[model samples]
Target chain A: MAQLVLSNVYKRYDDGPKGLFRKRKVHDYAVNNLSFTCEDGEFIGILGPSGCGKSTTLRMIAGLEEITEGDMYIGDIRINELPPKDRNIGLAFEDYALYPPLSVYENLAFNMRAKKIPEDKIQEAVSYVAPLLKVDDLLDMKPPALSGGQKQRVNIARAIVRRPGLLLLDEPLSHLDGKMRQTLRQEIKRMHHEIKCTTIIVTHDQMEAMSLADRIVIMKDGVLQQMGTPLEVYDDPANEFVAGFIGEPPMNLLPATIVGAGDGFEFAFEGSPLRVAVPEKYNPVVENNMQVTLGVRPVDVLIQPGTEGSGAVPVAVYENLGDERRISVRIGDTLLNTTTAEDVSYHHGQIVRLSFHAERTHLFDPKTGNRIRSNVEWR
Target chain B: MAKIELDGVTKRYGKNTALDNVSLTVEDNEFLVLFGPAGAGKTTLLKTIAGVEFPQKGLVKIGGEIVNHVEPMHRNVSMVFENYALYPHMSVYDNIASPMRSKLYKKDEAYIRETVERVTKMMKIDHLWERKPSQLSNGQRQRVAIGRCLVREPNVFLMDEPLAHLDAKLRHFMRSELKEMQSSFNTTTIYVTHDYMEAMSLADRIAVLNHGKIEQLGTSQEMYYTPCNEFVATLFGEPEINLFPAEVVAENGRLYLSALGQEGLPLEEDVCQALVHREDRSYDVGIRGNDVRFSFEHRPGWMAGTVYANEPIGNKVIMTVDVEGTHIRLVAPNDTRAGLDQPVYLSLNMKNAILFDSVDKSYVIRSDAQRFTQTAAAAGR
Candidate 1:
């Protein structure tokens, strides 16, 4: 096991010269100054959209890519100049690049053979790890004969046969179908526990990161957005991007302006008369007539039958989605989506009262897209 | 818009049977989703409907007209490829307007420009009209492809994973937009994808395919609540439905389902009556992760187990429990937490439990248990 730490890491690529006598210009940073630490035996996920430099960060840690600047430490030793072979990292990518000519057992032992480990020790290691990964019965089968899930299992087994200190998986479940992906996800969690190896997984799927990683590092355009436990990040996101990115159906980010109501502040919808009061705790930082973005998850929106007051909005689209019913209402040109239980039915064009859970609602500074926090204790 | 009908459609490429005796119907203006895993003939079926591939057997009909022998250009169906097949040299405006300018539907310049403008505005690509295909992003290119299809008043729209290449957030946004577009245009569409979420939210009905056969076809609710086989049940949910082999044991005068080495779970009166006369005793018990309840304390009907892994997803937590040798996943609240190997009690909501024939993997008894329970309660009241 190893504790990995990255401090102010940077990666930059230079564009080639276009014309004669013209110097090559340095492009934008592929990975900006990013810093984080993964404790020993802790599983962390690097999550981002494409082109966010998540893969670049992983390559740097694996010693595949040279860091442009800053220090990376494994335990107490800095490994800036170490070769990839010396990093002691196991890697499994989306493609299960297994040797088709060899049996599962041979595939698991290939790395040990390359490292010149004794046959007896290799046999011992394979015997111990194969059963843990539930591949004992599959040792004699070739990769070509195995199912997609089985091939992935053998691939992971091969990576761990060397007993590396760190395990890095890059979108391992991206190619599997939905059912197989769920099954393999559980197996990965179980394997981590049994092996107790420090692991880092890179994936664009938020659900995969939330279910498997102990902590998640969200990135965008080479910049670190937020790093926290899934619960912490989900319950209280750092900004509008994180809020909208973390949840399914995404969060509804409606433009609104803060207005004075009674003794507190309220958010008035930009294009409509709908208004929701800001929680008392946030009233200190919010001001009247301040333009802000109101963020609310679909699950937090309350929809009631019939028009009760000015808060009612007419439904534009209503869909029956198995266990839940999704209702979309058009507020000006923007459509706000809300989810309810399947039993709760609302016809399209029906008037429905909408309310927000004040505690669950979020307010953001529209200019910077950052959450508006009070000076007091606000997480 | 035209209704599409396929009767006993079968397609084969040498030794491989791409589609075998598949039959389905898409109603006029209905959004029908063809969903399955790779190698499930989803794309081939779409091509068959578009007259790109002729089935070896059976009939393809569009608006009561047989289209198996019709040329692809004369089918009046606009097909969108997974890869946005756009002309690199032409500007976005010309690419969208080309469909309206085709010889089959050539119109006056005023009519062509009006149609192109309406579709470009609807697809949110009005500002990118001057850019070529190479200058647009993947999402923008996809919108343009859809716009080309929408520009012409096509009878049927065939989309083969048009949004597969977009990022996750963009894909989610595009799904809702596609559904809204379908409804507003009132075009009969046959969309194809392997993503379950897209099938669930976007489709008026989904036809689940496996090995070129139609496993099941119904509305999303009907498919989720009353799946006819193991294949259909497994394709629908996250955390996947837990299925375990069990046996019905007649104890005294009651029938119980014994599974995972746990004490027998007494079957409901209606379920017991339904299964009492069957000679085969073995069955496959199906339960959704959301329906399985977990508690710290043991109750009479609860099965004792050990928590193997507790995974906290955003809205809910999925806990995998080991009962004897079998592992079953159950969904819990977001705040729920448990240590590995911690003792827990598991209770299944029998009302939602389904049973299947263990050997052939066919549904022996659908979940009429909920209906039976509700009816019994109403009578008692």
Candidate 2:
């Protein structure tokens, strides 16, 4: 097992004005100045939108893409120029990428034999992996005979058979259905726990990143938007994008106008006014009458009712979520989603007060997604 | 103003029966969802309801009137597919206005523009009116498709997993939006999807289908807490309802389960009497992980288990606990540092337990079990 690091990683395609297509730089940077480290035996996720260069970063680590200018290291070895085979990295792409002609057993043993590992060790490796991946009975079968999950499991087992220093997975669960994806997700996590190999997976899914990774690196437009543990990214996002990207109904990103913001934070939208206790940290940088994006997670947004003094917005829209009911209400341009963990029903368009926990609040710059400088981060 | 009714609906193509003997009634203004796994007749049923496909042996009625022979266009039902199916060359305005134009609305161009404006504002796509389909995001395109469907204020709507193509985050947002849109119109919509979350979050009631048959149809709460059978019990919940090898026992003039994990549970005599009187001893006791409490130390009523794995889900965690050689999930509150093989006790909250008949495998709620199984056998002890 090994820890990997990339500093100031850059990937520029040969298109447009410069390389691939024309004189116009289609993308100034596929990946730019990206830096993060995956500790030994830790699983880190690369999360971003499709064009945000998550794949490029993974490809760079796999030596499939060349880094324009960066320092890359795996454990103590700097493998900037090493061939992929010499890097001793195991990779599993979204397509499974299994050799169709070779049987499951032969495919797994191919890499081991190529590396000149002993035949006894090869046999021992297959025996050990087949049972864990639940593919022991399909050793002699070809990829054509295996189901999607089985194929992916076999592919995963094949990737880990060599016992590479790191495991790289690229959207391995994208092709599977919901239930199968979830089962396989658990299987992969269990596999990681059992093998204890430092792993890096790239995906555009926030749920996948939150569920599987010890830490998540969120990228956008080739820039590192945020990098932190999932909880850190969820609770205290570094930017508006990160805050909006993490949770469901997404952190309600509403444009807020700073009213009287000296000691207490005074907020008013449309016909409603709300007073928020300013975290002493943000109070310093948050000027009065400054424009900021006020964000709150749906789970934290409380439903205040029947209070005449600015407690609730008068609108209830019904959402039947299995055992619970979620009510969506509009406060000016922002929508608040309140969930009741019960089977009760609520009339739509009924006005209800919404009060947010000030401590769980987030403020971001309107122009840049960067979190508003505040006293909270220093704490 | 339409209540859809199906009687013995069966559609056969060659050797396959897409829909079989399906009889159902969708009340007027009711939001009915058709849910099933792939090839389980969810789409086929929707198509049949839309009058695009003919049923071989059943009558389909809309608004208290049978419309099995109605043409696709005359049924007043608009179908939206998983793909937005918008014209690429036309702007969103033209795409939305196409349905109205096809229906031969002879209102002046001003009325046409006014109608387009109303739907555009409602869908929040007013700013993207000039953009063509190729220039829009998947979500934007979907809004246009819905806008097109809503142009004439159609009485009944059919959406076939319209949000399936988007990413997870976008899909969540769109589900809420779609539900809001459906209720706002009050058009008595029939939505179809393979996603449990979508079905739960959006539908007024869900029709669970399997192999051309309706497993059950009820409100989301009914479907989750009170599933009628093994398939329904296992299909709806997440971390899945933990099924354990439990047997019924009677002691101290009370009903209890003689299980190994916990010393014993004060069995709900209703569920047990139902199971045991049915002469079913080898039964799988169904319990939700959320209802199961985990403790660091073993208690008398708590079952002993080893922590198998913990799956952190941001605010919460799903702990897979192994009890007596079987892996059962335990939904634990987040901010926990419980690790592998950590010894713990899983307490079964008998109040929420659902007992299944090991033989024939049907859920036997209190009264029904007693009625059917009184003479079958003695309550196992």
Candidate 3:
């Protein structure tokens, strides 16, 4: 097992020419000054949107891409100057590039054979890893004859067959269907537990990162935003982008102006009749007449059938989504979504009372988009 | 808006059957979603409605008129392809207005500008109007394609996974936006996607297809609560539905379902009554992850199991438990934690359990019917 550490790593790329007359002069930072550490045998997920430099960071760690600055260490050894072959890292990418001509057993033993490992040892390694990935039956079959899930399993088996100190997987489940993806995700988790190898997976899917990783590193536009466990990131996001990007149906971000009301602060939406009292804990971070954005997840918003209360908004759309009921209310130009139980019933155009859980509500600085975290601990 | 209908539609390409004996109806101004996995004939059905593909057998009707032999241009339907087929040379403005400039729907420049402006604004692509397709992102180009389709006052709209290529956050935003757009336009729509969530959230009715056959057609709730078969039951829901082969044993005037060497999972009285007439002993128990409950302490009627793995997925934790030899997944609160190989007790929410015939994969007992009748009998009592 290897504990990986990256200290202020940076990857820069030079832009190509835009026109015949001019050459681009500036260098683009695909990965800015980013740093994180993965403990030994720990599964870490680097998650972000496309072009967010997650893949770049993973490539740098794998020695596939050169880092322009800073040092990378694997358990006290500097590996920035080392080649990929010397890093002892097993790699599995989105494409399961298995050799079609070779059988599954041959594919698993190919890497060992190149390193001049004895015949019996290669055979023993393939046999041991095949059953672990549930590809024992597929040993004689080639990649072309196997299903997508089976092929991916074989690919992963080949990666672990070498027993490398570190394993790097990039969007390993992106190509599979929903059901197949879930099944493979469990298989990967099981394999990790059995092998106890340090692993780093880069993916854009929040659910995948949340479910698989021991810790998650969320990046955006080449900059590191937050690093925490799935629950920590989901429950208390560092910024508006992390808050909005982490959850399904997303967090509702409504631009509101803070105003003094009854010895406390209330956030009043612009050009709408919706207003919510700011939680008392946020009073220290917020000021009267200050511009702030109020953030609340869809699950945190409570909805009633009628507009009988002080904070009631008209429902624009109500959908029964089998597992849950989603209600959308238009406050100002922004559509705020609230998710309720599947059994909850509401009609379109019906007025509904809306209330945000004070403890769950988030206040953000409109200028920097950072969360206003006071001393109060979130439940 | 027009009501669309397909009667006994079957399309074949050489030896391959793309669509087999499919029939459906879309009411006027209603949004119908054709949902299935890849190669399930969702796109073919959408094309048949758009008059882009001709069916070998069956009638296609638009607005109560038979349009089986109608040309694509005369069908009065606009389609948005999975790949946004925007003209690279044309600006976003021109691309959106191209449908209006067609000979079939020729309009004055002022009217075209007004329509384009309205649609572009609605799609939030007005700022990118002057830029060509090459300059826009995938999401922006998709909006332009949708805007192009929306600019026309068509009889029906056919969208083939328009949001499939978008990122997760954008797709969620676009799903609700598309629903709102459908309502405001009041246009009949035939949307196709493999995403069950999209089908559930966007459709007034969903037609689930598999191997070119309609597996089930109903509201999202109906299909979810009363799935016709194991295939339909497993099609929706995350973690998929847990399906394990079991044997239905009747003893002592009570019913029990046993599987994987574990026995005596007692069924409710209502469920027993429903399964009494079934002669088949072999069955498949279908339970959603959320419907299965797990605890550290042993409870009566609960089966002992070992935790295979516990995955925390933000809001919920999905625990894969080994009950005997069968793997059963159960959902719990995110705060719930369990160690690997830890002994735990598992119980099913009897009200939510479903049963399927093992031989033919058909539903033997549907929980929705049991719940409905139970409520009715309670009201009567």
Cα error, candidate 2, residue A337 (Å) = 1.9
Better model by DockQ: candidate 1 vs candidate 3? 3
Please compute DockQ, using alpha carbons, for every candidate against the native two-chain complex.
Answer: 0.51, 0.46, 0.53
Please list the residue runs of candidate 2 whose C-alpha ends up more than 4 Å from where it truly belongs after superposition.
A15-26, A270-281, A340-345, A376-379, B83-98, B103-147, B151-155, B269-277, B366-381
| Rank by lDDT (best first) | 3, 1, 2
Give the distance in Å from residue B266's predicted Cα in candidate 2 to where it truly belongs: 1.9
What's the residue-level lDDT of A365 in candidate 2?
88
Q: Output the better candidate (2/3) by DockQ.
A: 3
DockQ of 1: 0.51
Ranking by DockQ: 3, 1, 2
Could you tell me the lDDT of residue B341 within candidate 1?
82
lDDT of 2 by residue, A1-379 (tens): 9999998888888533544554434267898789998899999999998899999999999999888878899988888899998998999988988899999999889888997999999999999888777788999999999899999998889989888899999999999877678778878887888889999999988888887898999999898988898778888788888888887557778777776645776665654454444455577777778888888777677675554555655653677665346777766644566655554555666756667776788888889877876754665
User: Candidate 2 lDDT, tens digit per residue, B1-381?
Assistant: 588899999999889999999998887778888987888999999999899899999999988778888887778888888887899999998998887677454456778899999989988789998999999876678789988888877758898998888766678767766766665556778999988878877776789999999999877666776677878887776767777667766667666666655545776656555555555555567888778888988677577888777766655677888788888887776666676778988777778777776776677653233322332123110
Q: Predict model 2's lDDT versus the native.
A: 0.79
* Ten contiguous residues with the weakest lDDT in model 3 chain B: B372-381
Clashing pairs for predicted structure model 1, backbone only: none
